[model samples]
Target: MENKHPYSELGYKIFFKIKPFLKKILRIKVVGVENIPLEGGCIIAANHRSHFDPPVINIVSPRPVIFLAKKELFEVPVLGWFIKKAGTIPVRRDSRDTAVIKKSISLLKEGFVIGIFPEGSRARPGEFRKPQPGVGYLIEKAKVPVIPVLIEGTDKVLPVNSKFPKLFKYNIDVIVGKPIKFEGISSYEHIAEKVMHEIRKLKGERHG
Candidate 1:
């Protein structure tokens, strides 16, 4: 991936280096990692909660996961640099950014794993938000396998607008849902709904 910034990826390197510090604060237990592809272009569509979601996914997945972070987040000088270095794409939510789309597609073709938060935006108190359908489009267009990841207990660890994660060692479980068949899928909506169902079923209890 071509990143314009020198420090865009610095965060990833630094984050990984200091992750041991987080170990004491967070009890992150990931399961079914074998469900993810060892290599090749595969999509990881997961639920969004804390800022830690992307980092957590990268830590456990054997393959490198390219996260589609919001474009604005990368605008900051240092933050932008590291985001690009981490191979994350900047997406413009309201309007389609051709540059970002092209870059993401290119990365997938290169056999790199891509991560997307299908919820589009963070979840609220009401019903779960519907996916933007872009992921389904990518799934069919890229013709790659889709892996649904259900993240439970992240919100409890750190809710929206909370600067620091709770000090307590909360149980954060990640469930890698089975890869669903993509051959017969004709529409993006169909596939989007399918992925949501898989995540819902895979969401487990906070503990145990």
Candidate 2:
């Protein structure tokens, strides 16, 4: 198999090394780490509320995650370089790009974890955006377990229009639900709905 995400190895290693500091700073509380399989390809579908969502999820995830980042992020000077080295896939929002889909499926088949925010972009804090069909398509084609993750407090950490992230003041919780499998479920939109439903359930539990 070709190593498309070559920087993942080094990038993840660095993340692991700094995890302690991040934990101390962010007060990240992660639940359901055991739900993630020890190996194999899987999809992690999470809600997006802040730009910090990706790194927060990445740090807590047991394996290196190949996230589908916005294409513009790859054009950023230093940040782009870092994300690319971290093996994030660049995607054009609101565009019908088959190449991105094919690459995701292929990566899943190769047993790499793919991280996705089905909302397609960050949602306003305390707001819910319906999951798009792209994630459903990937789940249907990959034939792998789909992990539903709910991240709370990131929106406050670095809210929309905020230039800097507030540190050491919020408790970020990452709740990873059981892996959901769909069989004979053909509707991509339906699959995306089911995934969001699970995420909402996680949200309920957090407050309940």
TM value for model 1? 0.83
Q: List runs of model 1 lying over 4 Å from the truth.
A: 1-24, 76-78, 125-127, 204-208
lDDT of 1 by residue, 25-85 (tens): 6877778889998878888988887777887787777766888888787887776776777
Off by over 4 Å in 2: 1-5, 206-208
Lowest summed-lDDT stretch of 10 residues in model 1? 3-12
Give each model a TM-score. Answer: 0.83, 0.93
Shift in Å, residue 24, candidate 2: 1.7
What lDDT tens digits, residue by residue, belong to model 2 across residues 8-41? 6666778889987887789899888889887999
Instruction: Provide the overall lDDT of each model, using Cα atoms, as 2-decimal numbers.
Output: 0.76, 0.87
